[model samples]
Target: MGRRSLSGKVVVITGGARGIGAATARALASRGAVVVIGDLDVEPAKETAAAVGGSGHALDVTDHAAFSAFLGSLGQIDVLINNAGIMPLAAVTEEPPETTARQLEINLHAVIHGTRAAVGIMRRQGSGHIVNVASAAGKFGFPNGSTYCATKFGVVGFSEAVRAELRGSGIEVSCVMPGMVRTELISGLSEIGFLRPVTAEAVALGIVRALEKPRFDVFVPRRLNALTRFQRLVPRRLSEWAMRVVGADTALFHGASSAARAAYETRVHG
Candidate 1:
């Protein structure tokens, strides 16, 4: 199939205020698409919209009413990008119920809710694209990040099911599994010592590529895809051991906070 052109397409993106979401909005708008951006932060949303010459609205992806209203306002959504998420560090038992719930709400349920809302509109139009931003963690579980992994894995699974369900419907669903991308999410990791990163622009570039090709899944660098696959095949015990040896805290996915640092200090000093 010939690649689809983004020209004149109507795209809606969550987390569009900054990071990958903002970059994606610009990327699509640059291709002449009309973009409707939704973000919890109105200031950044306005800035991104101004830069891209598109529309921006304040929204929390977890709120069903807010999401519906955002979509209702657009009336037509050609591309839907579910890009809002948060990672808070916690051991399984250490995580507050609220933290896990919020993560599930934003990272997982938002995708479910967005897919439902967008599909209804797209099915009516008979043409659209849905891009759900997942991560390498989605493919292989990380210790201390079990909840985060579960949510991202749910994204991959949900995208697959709907993609197959929507086959030949003039609508396509693509899951973008990005590795480390330089974004504000990093601020959540100040206590962490290691840094491996990719720029939001680069991740955005990969997303645009995915949009054109409409692939089932997109992994930035492409090579990382193989590494994730290999990781998935490794025994859980061995993988966990290797992760500890390298000081690769799976908790990194949940993210670090001053509070978390204080807790760690208490544990160490006590």
Candidate 2:
């Protein structure tokens, strides 16, 4: 596909305050996409929106009503980026109920709601794109991030289904999966991973590419696709054994929430 132009396109990124959202919002704005920063944090969202000279709205992904209202406020959106999510970092059996619920609300449910709202407008307009920011968790399902994996998997599945359903509708949906990104998500990693945690800027550019080409699925860097394919092919027994031996689950648990972080800190530091 050829490099597509983003001039005058309107993009709505759900978690536009920091990390990937902020980076993507900026990247798109620079390329001619009028960005809309919607986040729970007002100051950060406003800052990013102002930087892009677009717009910002303090909105929570999980709040269905508020999210719909916020979408309505934006008038017409050419692109919708579902990027808000959380990793609780707990063994499935040991995971807290609240943490799991929170992850589901933000990750899976929010994607569904956003797609629903976006589809209505996009289909009517007959030209739009949706980008769901999933994770390598959706592909590999690392040890302690089971719930997080579940949600991302749901996103991937949802995106595929939506794409099939909207066959000739000009509206497109893409699942943008990123691997071990170097961001707040992995605060303590410092710099060690299968591939040095990729930068937000790199991820942002990948998203922009996806919008221009309108693919149903977009993997970051375009290189991780093969690795993800290999991860899926490994026998389950071997995969679990290797993960346990390497303490992968424990690492994910610690990488999640502050409560999990505290517990993880005690275990790793002890």
**What TM-score do all the candidates reach, one by one?**
0.87, 0.88
Per-candidate Cα RMSD to the true structure, in Å, reads 4.8, 4.1
What lDDT does candidate 2 reach at residue 207? 92
lDDT of candidate 1 over 10-30, digit per residue (tens): 889898988899989888889
Write model 2 residue lDDT over 1-270, tens digit each, in one string.
686789999899998888999999989998988999898888989998999898888888888999999898788889999998765566779877777788889999999999999999898888899899998677766766788899999999988899899888988888988876766667654333444578899889889888877776677767678766655689878767755554554556443556535653343221
lDDT of 2: 0.81
- Candidate 1, backbone clash total: 3
Residue 221 displacement (Å), model 2? 3.6
- Candidate 2, 29: how far from true, in Å? 0.7
Candidate 1 clash pair list: 87-254, 88-254, 89-254
User: Which residue pairs collide, candidate 2?
Assistant: none
Which portions of model 1 miss their true places by more than 4 Å?
A: 188-195, 232-270
